[model samples]
Target chain A: DAGITQSPRHKVTETGTPVTLRCHQTENHRYMYWYRQDPGHGLRLIHYSYGVKDTDKGEVSDGYSVSRSKTEDFLLTLESATSSQTSVYFCAIMGGAGLAGGNAYEQYFGPGTRLTVT
Target chain B: TQLLEQSPQFLSIQEGENLTVYCNSSSVFSSLQWYRQEPGEGPVLLVTVVTGGEVKKLKRLTFQFGDARKDSSLHITAAQPGDTGLYLCAGAPPGSARQLTFGSGTQLTVLP
Candidate 1:
């Protein structure tokens, strides 16, 4: 979807282990976001990046950290994975201009990465 | 409590039947977006409504944004088997980052 690629499409990890998910975009979009999807929760934003090396926490940022050293890549890291973090992770890139045209913005999603923790 | 709550969490209807899903929120949003997601895939953007009381149509699907900017609805006419999927509604509040708060979503099954 929209030239976005997420690595490790499916992964099974143990609790307390460190895991990292990668999102790569070819569109050169200025904004990038990481979200998690569960059964009851539709999609919760974990973190977002407005530009390279500039990151901010989202509504559900606890226990997760993100880094964006390059414009085309955004990485989400689970410092210590937990069973509660087992869910489908999606990467999205925001399109359109700056805040002036924010109303016209649209988010394009990646295929998604499924992580299972035991 | 969810910022945006979607009604009829699960819906099943016969082919050719009509149905509507509602999403309500207490907070006023600057814009609302509709998305359809299939199994093993991320949600795809269907439409985005900005102006209050705005109505947009994409073929058989009709989407409306509430005048108060706190609610929205999606209506499908003459549903078909291919319409089976999860529908999600997301809202963008008036802010700088332009982040979105999503609804729990409505799962629909159009049985033939």
Candidate 2:
């Protein structure tokens, strides 16, 4: 509902193949993030972007790469897919009211992309 | 890595029943948030608690932050079928606004 969308809502790829998922937002928020959701792991941050071309790795950034060349789009790429990477991927933008005079803790997430690597 | 542990990985209750979900951690958090996610969709923000011993209510749902800022709880009164979903709690550590530590989540199924 925050004007966010993820491409390739569902996909099934074979192992060792390259794959990419895209997150697009119209809110123009300064922060964007990539997350993977699994049954027992909850939601894990994979990567995040603070500004155009400025990005940082998150807790589970291994086996993944991201690029944010523009404010509206952030891409997550898996160089070689693996069964361990099969999970629901979500893209989020951080905005709204927050504490410490910084961006709030609220995150607006996209519908999510379901990637299945066999 | 700071981890938020949630209890009752899975729950099932009949409609109109009362239920509570817990989120706990050993590290202190500057703020905590709750989100509900339904099938095939992303999680949606429910409420945010920033102060210790703070209580906030959203309709039949009540949220309380622990007195020590290390835990929080969600109490649902007369739960409905629509309340069935995955509930997640995320905490923002002190001086950090760029990221949050999330709980593994509690999946609730309110049967009719």
Best by the DockQ measure: 2
- Measured against the true two-chain complex, the DockQ scores of the candidates, in the order shown, are 0.60, 0.62
Inter-residue clash pairs, candidate 2? A98-A104
The whole-model lDDT of each prediction reads 0.92, 0.93
lDDT string, candidate 1, B31-61, tens digits: 8899999999999999988888999999999
Positional deviation of residue B108's Cα in model 1 after best superposition, in angstroms: 0.6
Per-residue lDDT tens digits for candidate 2, residues B59-107, read 9999999999999999999999999999999999888855888999999
User: Compared with the true structure, what per-residue lDDT tens digits does model 1 show for residues A1-118?
Assistant: 5799999899999999999999999989889999999987899999999999999999899999999999999999999999999999999999884232445578889999999999
Instruction: State the lDDT at A37 in candidate 1.
Output: 97
Fraction of the true interface contacts (Cα pairs closer than 8 Å across chains) found in each model:
0.61, 0.65
For TM-score, the strongest prediction is: 2
Which numbered prediction scores highest in lDDT against the true structure? 2
Q: List the residue pairs that clash in candidate 1.
A: none
iRMSD in angstroms, per model: 2.6, 2.5
- Model 2 chain A is weakest, by summed lDDT over 10 consecutive residues, at A96-105
